[model samples]
Target: MSNNGGNGGGSVLATFEAGTQGWSGTSLAGGPWSTTAWSSQGSRSLQGDITMSAGSQHYLLKSGSTNFTGYTKLRATVKGASWGSYGSGLGVKLFVKHGSSYAWKDSGWVTISAGGLANLTLDLAGVNLADIKEYGIQFIGASNASGTTAVYVDNVVLGN
Candidate 1:
């Protein structure tokens, strides 16, 4: 992990410039994650195919000793193929692992239009970030629906 001292926040966690950077997705409807040229920060971004479903959780994880002790937020640049039904279920979250179980945090529903890159931020004010064995990005919501959709993620950072 490289620290960029980002926009008055903290440091760069993953930019997917080289590759998946150890990030992998689970419960994917479309998958085998790969890098794409569609990026908001660097040369490439991580891409995955996800099926939208009510009350479903799909995410990607990377293992590392990430210390978020002084960081108050997590930010990432994201792009989506289709945001089916614009319900309150469309948003992102964070999963941080300290022990065996992972502690989760939410970003609420963000207004991201299709075909454009959006900057999404999640609060880390109450998250336990010290001695983190793993960290991840979780996409939540898209309630009462089903089908595969594409999502791209890039320039992940932790800051205040």
Candidate 2:
């Protein structure tokens, strides 16, 4: 349970155990997103077809008002299939929204090897945690052949 009754710190934001778990996907490249059997925890994971193109933002988001006032970290398990590369410029981020404003925190460019699972942690500094009306994942830019990459995310949690 979260401090604000599942809307804040000490909460599992998503596990993808029950369908999409309120998360939806969108991408500039028009790739599809869904829940897949490949997961690091539970029975499913959120899968997004992210394009390895500059300026393309592919994400899976859940809209809600959450009070994450005391949380300083966001964690998740991720894996990628057919990933082209895992070097500089290839990264991911977590974003939180308050009203019309949004704050983003990078995952320090954590590497997700081809078909390998990895734990990702991002700092929640400078975010308006008190009124987080939306939260999501962002697949950052990657300079590779123009193609789509399959990425899976699971066990998203918020904590100290």
Pull out the clashing pairs in model 1: 10-159, 89-141
1-160: candidate 2 lDDT, tens digit per residue: 4333242447787777677777877773433344664877656788877666655567777887778777898777777775555434445666666645554445565544456566777777877778777777776655543466687878788877
- Output the number of the TM-score-best candidate: 1
Q: Give candidate 1 regions above 4 Å deviation.
A: 1-6, 82-89, 99-101, 111-113
Top candidate on lDDT is 1
Superposed on all Cα atoms, model 1 deviates from the true structure by an RMSD in Å of 3.1
Give the CA lDDT, 0 to 100, for residue 116 in model 2: 59
Cα-based lDDT at residue 113, candidate 1? 41
lDDT of 1 by residue, 31-121 (tens): 5355664777657888877777787777777776667788887787777765445344346655566644565555655644445456778
**With candidate 2 superimposed using the best TM-score fit, by how many Å does residue 119's alpha carbon deviate from the native?**
1.7
Please provide TM-scores, in order, for all candidate models, with all chains considered together. 0.76, 0.75
**How accurate locally is residue 74 in candidate 1, as Cα lDDT from 0 to 100?**
78
